[model samples]
Target: MTVLLIALGAALGAPLRYLTDRAVQARHGSPFPWGTLTVNVAGSLLLGGLLAAPVDPAVTALVGTGFCGALTTWSTLSYETLRLARTGKRRLAYANAALSVAAGLGAAFLGYALVTALTG
Candidate 1:
């Protein structure tokens, strides 16, 4: 059941991630991968909130492991950063790496804090 739930969540998450990435990237019209960054930060925020909350293990598996795992793409970020560097957009590559890490962490922390405060 847990596995099925996870699969189901992933099925939903993957499509959502793709759609969101397309929409955000289309709007930004920048070489920087704003779409990947958006999804990663969003996933981190959601996972952090789910972890901080007193949710069931099944829910955690479904949302955190499955949804977030599917929503966030470390591989895509790595590839995009490398592509930017190779294409002589070294500055943008560096910025993308640094900003993604910083923003994802910040969003996660914020989510955790919000959930903790609300639950208390």
Candidate 2:
């Protein structure tokens, strides 16, 4: 049941993530990997909210363990940053890395706070 829920969530999350990434990339044009950053930040916030919510275990498994896990792509972010660095865009690469980590964490914290305030 847990595996099934995760699989279902992942099915939805992966395509959503892909579409979002493409849309952002289409608008922004990816010399900077804005898509991955956007998704990661968004996913972090979502996961935080899910965590803070008084949801059932199954829902948590679906959203946090599955959806969010699929929606965010740290590996892709790292690859893009490394690719940027390898291509001599060291400054942009570092900025991307720093901003993604910092802002992702901040967004997660903010989401958690918001959910906590609402629920509490």
Candidate 3:
């Protein structure tokens, strides 16, 4: 049951991640990988919110583990950063790494705080 739920969530999240990444990348001409950053932060925020909420384990498994796990791509981030560096965009590569971590953490904290405040 939990597995099925997780699979279902991943099925939705994977395509959503791809589409969202493409859409966001299309809007920005920078090769800084805005798309990857957006999805990672968004996934972190959503996972934080879902975890903070008084929800069931199944819900967590489905959305938190499955959806967020699929939505955020650490491998892509790594690859893109390497690509940037190799392509002579070293500054952008470093910025991408720094900003991704900082923003993802910030978004997660924000989501957790927001949910906690609202629930309380």
- Residues 5-93, model 2: lDDT tens digits: 99998998999999999999999755998889999999999998888999999998899988999999989999999999999999999
> What TM-score do all the candidates reach, one by one?
0.97, 0.97, 0.97
C-alpha displacement of 26 in model 3, angstroms? Answer: 0.5
- Residue range 1-120, candidate 3, lDDT tens digits: 999989988998899999999999999989889999999999999988887899999999999888999999999999999999999999999999999999999999999999999997
Clashes of each: 0, 0, 0
lDDT of 1 by residue, 8-102 (tens): 88998899999999999999868999999999999999988997999999999899988998999999999999999999999999999999999
What is the clash tally of candidate 2? 0
Global lDDT of model 2: 0.93
lDDT of 3: 0.94
Q: What is the lDDT of residue 60 in candidate 1?
A: 91
**At residue 18, what lDDT does model 3 achieve?**
99
